[model samples]
Target: MEKSPDAFRTISEAAEELDVPQHVLRFWETRFSQIKPMKRAGGRRYYRPADVELLKGIRSLLYREGYTIRGVQKILKEDGASYVAGVGRGEIEPRKREGEMASAPPPGMSKPAPRVKGAKGEAAPAAEAPAQPLLPLGEVRVVVNRLSENHADMLRAALRDLGDARRILDPSQGR
Candidate 1:
């Protein structure tokens, strides 16, 4: 028989609904301190509705959004489990972590000033930060994948440039 919407689910049921293995669910319990499943005799676990939602959020963050376990932990700490649950429920969208913008302006380009209401109720421009672009989940994955691939090349080029500069500065040291 199908269960009620508010019914507690077993570890296997929860794992199946989340499309993850039961062991993965068990592992998540260890990593996320916020996941507190009710334990009965024989140490059987029963996941409440809220717990399932939190797991879905964590799954989305790790697998779909490509966030590290530590990153997800920071989100749980800063934003709370309820916020994560909201993300799982599709009521809230996940945002990029600080310093991890997907659509940052190119270097040498300044961000636009923010618009504000003046004392006379006129729209005035104020110094506000640029808004972040809301990219689709698929596009975000592509961008992140490209960045990881290019990051090493960028670092290698930087190191080569630094070495060449050092050689030019100290000819004797090059020997």
Candidate 2:
């Protein structure tokens, strides 16, 4: 069944509804600075309907329209509501209201200066390289198993010791 829009969501629920990872939502909370969800005990997050709507808008801007984190910040600074509207439509173009610069490029287009190798060297591209594809879960599990074997072994040893101590302390247990 479809959940109502007024439903309050945990961080995981909000992330799933917005089609983003919970870590991404956590990161967004740090970057956007405007996304402030109420926190229950034990650091659990509860998002209101407005918070969910804002997350949806931010997700559209970052994933669909390809806005950088900084670009979204700039858009929010200029016109907060308009930015949300643009994101809802999956468009990153800045609105040119009266008296604003009409010929300016969108916020995402503004890039940092290219890095030069040396005084006489040509400037290299400042943009980061395209990300590589992530490894599959099976491969990741194998890697994790290899990496965590020592920790897992220690935990197993500790559990065995606890079991031995329990048997020794129990008078009814067979010697």
Candidate 3:
């Protein structure tokens, strides 16, 4: 089980949990100015719970809601703290006009359902017909083997050229 960020996670751990890169988190720190994680000796970053939550909000805004980095920065500058708190506390609700609920997708244009795995470890459709089986493993293996052979041949040719150059440079070994 993974510990919460309140216990302080290394930058890599935070990035892994948040599904973002360490450089991205560093960039966000520069942009948002609210994600100040603790930097230890040798400049190792350790993220707190608040920082982790802020990262989650930023990710949701960027990836899920499709907000640009600048747009997210502006949102953070305006109401980021409160929004983060609200989302963390699960107090975020869609604000609709009286008696109006969020609209559903139009008929025949619904989002695809998640595929469920069958007992044989194959993906079965949630509804409707099962998807066609993918290309056989044997076919994929043959393709990979061919590619590997080509790569090995190229490497060998390059190495031979390097050896020739070395022999030329060290003239004592006659060509």
Candidate achieving the largest TM-score: 1
After superposing candidate 3 on the true structure, give the runs of residues whose Cα lies further than 4 Å from its correct spot.
88-90, 93-175
In Å, residue 144's CA in model 2 sits off its true spot by 43
Give the per-residue lDDT of model 3 (tens digit) for 1-175.
9684358889999899889888998988888878899999999998887778778877766665445687667777777666854554456631222211114332344556456667788986567566667543222212223234655555566556666776688667666
Candidate 2 residue pairs in backbone clash? none
> lDDT winner among the candidates?
1
Please list the C-alpha lDDT of all candidates, in the order they appear. 0.79, 0.67, 0.66
Residue 68 Cα positional deviation in candidate 2, in Å, after optimal superposition: 0.6
- For each candidate, what TM-score against the reference? 0.61, 0.49, 0.49
Query: Which of 1 and 3 is ahead in TM-score?
Result: 1
Write the number of the candidate with greater lDDT, choosing between 2 and 3: 2
Candidate numbers sorted by lDDT from highest down: 1, 2, 3
List clash counts for every candidate, in order. Answer: 0, 0, 0
Cα lDDT for residue 84, candidate 2: 74
Candidate 3 TM-score over all chains jointly: 0.49
In model 1, how large is the Cα lDDT of residue 70? 91
Per-residue CA lDDT of candidate 2, range 72-159, in tens?
7877777784467555645655343332222334456645434545345755454743555844322322212332466555556655
